[model samples]
Target: MIYVDPSGDDSGPGTVERPFATLQRARDAARPGTVVTLRAGTHRLTDTFLLTAAHSGTVYQAHGYGTPYQEKVVISGGREVTGWTPSGDGTHRADAPGPAPRQLYADGLRVERAALSLDGHTLRRTAGGYTVEGTGPQRWDGDVEFVYRGAYPWSEGRCRVASVSGDAHATTLTMADPAFAQATRLYHSVLTWEGPGAGESYGVDSPTSVENSPAFLTEGTFATAGPVIHYRPRGGEPPAGVAAPVLETLLHARGAHDLTFRGITFADATWLRPSTPQGFLHYHGNGYYDGGALETVTFAEGQGQVTVPGDHASMPGNLIFEDTSRTTLEGCRFVRLGAVALEFRGAGAGNTVRDSEITDIAGGGLVIGDGARDHRVENNHIHHIGLDYRGSPAVLVTGARDTVIAHNEVADVPHAGIVVYEGRGTKVLNNLVHDTMRVLADGGGIYVSGPQGDSHANGALIRGNVVRDTITPYNFGLYTDYGAAYVTVEANAVHRADAPVVLTVWPPLEHVTFLGNVWDADPGDPPGGVVLKDNTTVAGDAFDSDPRAVAITRAAGRRPARHRH
Candidate 1:
């Protein structure tokens, strides 16, 4: 056994009376089958703490399990900012001299960045960059950015400002190198869409908002210069504590097995790669391409087909477990993170994440990538994710095999709730997903694309989920798009969506079955090679009182989650 406390000494023996100061010291002193007990306090990490193959069969737990006095444990990757002086304009200034983080927290609440909406401005694409109809931001410290939607409703991209000039009638904004060229290439790549409203498929072309500028600083926002950090107070109240993320990875392990982490909270980590010169070029469902130029553009037989190398790379997770097996995380919390919360990658098998909470992130929640098998994620609460990058889903499963994602509550996201793209024998069952696609479009509450094994053999199953309140412009309740094949969607209840189910016919879905489902809106027609059997449509209040819908809603989302105070 080993013990760790935040107020203890590092030179002491790892005992209950005299504990080790850091987790690293207790981990180094532990054996293979040891239990490392932690006292209740904050353990702020400057770098990632590691556990490799030598630390198999280890358990990290709270100070007292199954007791009344079990307090909270926090493992944070944030650095506290001191010496905050009042700037006398209802603002505060601190001496922070580094790359600015994408997220900030004041007294454990998320703070918004400085922004100005450009909703009514006319922005025309010029040779260098763009020409705005009104006067642009003229007093920036060289890191002003534009968060804009592309021509496709499913895409969102960002770029930096190099210089801004011209008169009050129109200002010419010059974009930064390489990122501007890469974003323009992706925006003009989609040339054809045969399905509904082909001519009216253009979404917003101009930027909706400009971020990270001093000119846009308001009463509830914060901004950063080269060596100074500026924050405007909300309603003239001073904050008790202020912290910003500094490290990227909080935990990274490879080739380990049989580990457990219980009753802990991981918080405040930042990822700065998206703020680089490459920028963020979002595609769909956690796939982003930053590889400068398109590999191939073929207009021969397929007009809008651009060949990526392997369907683009996914965003890296901040806490990664590679080639690990038989791991478990229960009653944990992950908050104020800048990237994906957890990832299982590279020959991983038989892992489980249950009864946890993941919230307040800039990227996706939980990602099980390729080369993973037989994992289970259930009974968790995930909310308010994709706060910066709007294209990421709450839970994304791609190219994994035999995964089960069931009985979780997912809400308050910008994109899809759960997305499965090219996985085999995966089961998504009994989840309660709502208020999704709150910003972007063309995704659904639960979406599936690409093949999932053979139709006659082990295929995919999406069963008994309750999805509701998808109020986006172009979205569906249950969607199967982009050449999806070999799937069964059964007994699900969908309400208040654009449509119940959107089965795409462009790439032409094949061998898909929708059986015994309940919806508020009727799916007009089934596409070719798809089957719809015994589905019922209830209108208005009648849908809420239906027996099948009542049973499914009652059984879903039993566990609610809370943040660590």
Candidate 2:
């Protein structure tokens, strides 16, 4: 076992007494089957360190000794700094004559000098003294005094504080006040108290605003309600012509079979960027062929921590897989993203995702096939997804076979909860789908569509799923179109929705079965090329207008035995 410390001596043997100075040196000296241990401290990394495919059976361990909490290592690419010059106006002046400017700290929020008044509390050379409603003002004889929570950007020795009114109430501040031309705006960093109640600490992106200025004031009431609080800028329009940043993915294999990463955190704080591009982390054919097998990778965020700017839309398509096999991801969280969370495109098989949380996404949550097959998605908690366009399914499976979807909780999406398109021999069972299609039209809990041309989707089993609280301008709970054939829907519970099921067949479906399903809403008249057998409904009447030439038997007050075909 060779111990390496990047900050320690390089002249001695690579042991605890005298460690290797650089990680590159330790990696170079290590052969296959070598366990290289990193010292228990922060190792600041710069540039990409490539562990090539040659070093097989080598485990590069970081912070492996001592208590796990005490062993800390941060691998970062360092910080990027940009220079700024003060305008030397009345609000900005050189307080100290030195190479580095004198630093000042403040408590209130930061705004422009033009928004300040004689009775207002500003950070401009103030030896603080005032009386608000007989309460003596707190005195701060410093060069810079903060009125509210301050804004800390990546600049050096400069911050802005919010202004206070004569009554000791904080005023709404703006970034358009000429003092913030080249400034970075940190949103909603204020602490407020109403009367004798406990103070509330607002997060950075509270008080939603839609102004064009960089800093929009937040919305909050004083001890007594004042003007409507709305002066902040909502982050929507991409900063002029600056396109979103592109995320670069680097994958390396070190002769290890079964490389997996689970419960990792990836977040972006800047606006005008998509956080990440579509398919940020992807693996296709290289890692496995080079004596490595990547399996069971999970990427999720921590609880209650908002990863992106609250005003912007959700991020998109964080993970994509192609030709990888037997992977599973569950109990994860995604927010403020654009496209799908986990997507498998091209010839992958046997993946499963369940019991996870996905929300605030513009696109769908899980899409299981462009060419993949035999996937199972079960028991997931999916909500607040599909905010972008219409027709986005929370779980969409296309061009896949023998897939099983069961026991999941899905809601608040813009499209259908589960959609099986161009897939054969798939089963959707015992799931609860509700509150879908929030924005656009064409909503449904489950939609099954067939493939075009010579490819036919045959033999699907849809059973025992509960559909509720679905609302849209158009559509139904279960819809089939084109050449979909041999589908079985049985013993399902649907409640409080318009248009429960609509089956449309253009090319004449073959051997369709609807059995023992209970519908609380009006079960619409079935179309042609469908069969209904012994289906029980609470609304006594069989069908509004039967379009299919099949037997419809209703057995009420009698318990029906479970039947399987």
Candidate 3:
């Protein structure tokens, strides 16, 4: 067992008596199964500590030795070494002014080369020294030693050059020929110069050119590269792949038998970058092939943003479980996403998602199926989604089997609340769907459609669901077509200002059952036949001789039965 303080004096024996000064020293001294405990405090590092196969079983734990709240540990990157105070003088001197400060400059800091981590202290720049203010005996701030130096083109002109070297380094800016600064004022710009070595300059309207070129006022001559780029004055959009900087995802698993995360919160400002292909978390195609138990993790994106590209069919913040088995997600939340929240794809089986909340999405919420089988979805809250396009449903299922959806609350979606297409043995029960079609051309609460030749969805049971406040140009609470068969609808509550439900079978339905349902609005005169037994319609007149339509006598509290027209 070796102790690495990262901030302690290096003169000791790397133990309690004389501790090692850096994390890398402890990592180098440890054996294969060693546990390195990092004392709680900000331990700034100059580089990213990449763990390879050799460090597989190595446990790097950060624990507080003193007050729990006061202990913190942080690793950082890309810091520049300033002047250090001598032991006798007890005063510091400037070391070549380090990197140029940004528009806002605060000093008295520790600089490193690569990634940095801060623990148990607030990191804020100050005039004298970087303030690591909090509380605890284990609190300290120091930078790990690493050096990375890269050069960019320096055109002789009046333009501000802003550059971020690597990770955990602040952006630095310098004005080229500061006297002529008025002729060129840079703002959120990047300039690329093709010379002996390709160099780049970044800032607002910064300039770069080929060779040791004196800076010239050349318009549209510089290009920049990185994760983020914002043009000023007119305030143009960021480049395609740019996103806010933040540590993205964290995972904890117990063993190879598949660890499960039931109720976890994943929150960050840059959870999903709008112009980039980054979500908070993604787990797809990492599990068993023969439907073995895979790792299951649920993310509640609390006040986070997720972006998906416009050209892709899938949405952002989506969790796709492909060819996995026995995974479930319940009681999660999603907001401001580009696509569906959860998608089961490519022969995935035995998955379930229930009692979750999805909102503010550019696309619809839940999409199960598309080569998935034997899934259950129940008791979810899906609302306020699908602003971009039409025909986005709250729940869409296609090519699935043995799926049961029940007791869900869906509202304020664009197209249909629930849609089932091309599958078998699906049971939808006791769901409350309302306020659908805020932005759709035509909408329905429930729509079931099948493929061209194949009969759509056999042995489906839709019962005891409530449909209300669906206002669309072509509205229907429930519509089934495209050679559907053997679907039973019973004991449902539907209320609409317009038409409530429409049962249209193009090739005609076979063996469909409708029974014991209460309709506030009628299906008109002569409701069709299958089995319309024990049904009560609020409409004044009943259908006459419709094969699928049944008449029922209304009682005070008993279940209605189908009556012959």
Candidate 4:
């Protein structure tokens, strides 16, 4: 057994009396079944911790920690920013370590990224960015930046200033060039957050157009001016000390089987990969592939403990286990990061993430699969996710098979509670999902989209889950949108929502089944075009209400489900 203590030394022999100071040291010294027992305390790392097949453990043997679940062994990516100088306008300035991170925290709460906008004046859209009218842009320090919510809910783009020239009527900001021109096409639209088109959007022809115009000064805003990060508190409270994330990822392991990460709390990372505002998560298919796979983008470590390959690109997540099997994360805590808490790449198989709590992040809690298989995500508590970025779901499982997502509690998010897309033989059972789609307008408590032209979700089962209180126009307790196919809904309970089940497909769905479910809703809740079977509900249609029934009557050869009028 190897020992690790936050207060220990690196040069020591890693004994319990003189434990290793860093996880990397312990990782380097690990062999198969090497129990790396961690001493109780915080472990703030300055670099990415990697483990490979050479350090792999046996299929069922525990290789990592032997600590109790109550032990607070925090793995943090943050360093407190001291010497905050007050300019006295209810704001403070501190030297930021360059290139700069997108999110910050104060006393364990998320601080908004700094944004500048006019009271009523809309920005003029430009190819590079929007132009700030009058004195608004003129007030910014030279190091100011502009970040916009992406056209898609799942994407965001940020750009540093190439130049900011102020005229009497306007200040035009020419954005610095990005590493990949693909990014230019990725975030062309500035999404409207609320109002006329709450979720509607239009391309930004002028860099200054107000698409999703963020009303000025409601939340905390921040920006870096050269070496300084200027911050405005949310409600007149200056931060005791600014907390900036110094690491991009907590742990990165690929094709390393039989590993276990237990009883550890991972926190405070400033995930930035790719470069600029569009991290590794840009549009696939030449920047227009509907936001799922993040495979093509190459990532390299950069200055801010982030990895942005070119001059621009940034994407981050807490943990990445790719091309591996039989891995497990049990009794762990993941908090306060800019991207997904844990991500498993395409080759990710037979991995399990259970008995964990993930919260306070700008991105999703767990983003698993992209054609991966047999991943089990169960018995976890996920909430307050996508706090900064609303496009991410609590759990996004794409094209993963034999995956078991059960007994998890997901809440307080802007998008779907749990999204299963293009997966075959997947099970989403007995989970509790609520308070989601808070910022987004169209989504589901448990959403299933895709099985696009290229893929199909065959033999998928969504059974025994509880969904509630998802407010939005197209939001439902269970939604199968776009082109989801071959899905089954059985024995589920959907309550307190505007709609219980929705089928808003484009070309329509196929081989879908709904059986023995409980939907407690008001009158006319299901919204029509539903074919229920052997089920119960407070209101709405039954068996004949199923859209598949319409499909059966429409054509002889198993026609597609019809749309609701």
What's the residue-level lDDT of 239 in candidate 4? 63
Candidate 2: residue 373 lDDT (0-100): 74
**Candidate 4 lDDT by residue in tens digits, 275-334:** 343333332111122232223222122111111223222234578887878888877789
Error of 1 at 320 (Å): 0.8
Residues 1-565, candidate 1, lDDT per residue (tens digit)?
8889999888999889999999998888888889999999899886798989998889888877545777789998888777888867888888663467677788888889898887776788765578776665555553678787644577777777778887867788888767676666665545465765343222225677878876677887887765567788799777548888888899887899998898889898888866776777677777777664456444443446443323466788888999999998878898998989888988899998988999998999999999999999999999998998888899999989999999999999998999999989999999999999998998899999989988626788999999999869788989888778899999999999999888654567899999999999878788687999998999899999999899888887736533221
The candidate with the higher lDDT, 2 or 4, is 4
Model 1, position 22: C-alpha lDDT score: 96
- Winner by lDDT between candidate 4 and candidate 3: 4
Instruction: List residue ranges in candidate 1 displaced over 4 A.
Output: 133-136, 166-170, 189-205, 292-311, 559-565
Instruction: Tell how far residue 267 is off in model 2, in angstroms.
Output: 4.3
lDDT for model 4, please. 0.64
Residues 1-565, model 2: lDDT tens digits: 6776758765667887788876666667777667666765433333234454444345555443223342433232222111212232212122111111111111111111111112332322222212233212222112122121112110011122223334354223321211222121222122233343123222222211111111221221000001111111113211111111112211222222212222221211111121111101111100001112222211222111111122222222445555555554433344433446556666666766654556655456777775677787776677776443233467877778788887777888766778777667788887778887554444467777674213225478887777766776565766655466777877776655666676554454655667777674545566566777676555434332222211221211112222110
TM-score of 4: 0.78
Steric collisions counted per model: 0, 25, 50, 38
Error of model 1, residue 108, in angstroms: 0.8
Q: Model 1 lDDT vs. the true structure?
A: 0.82
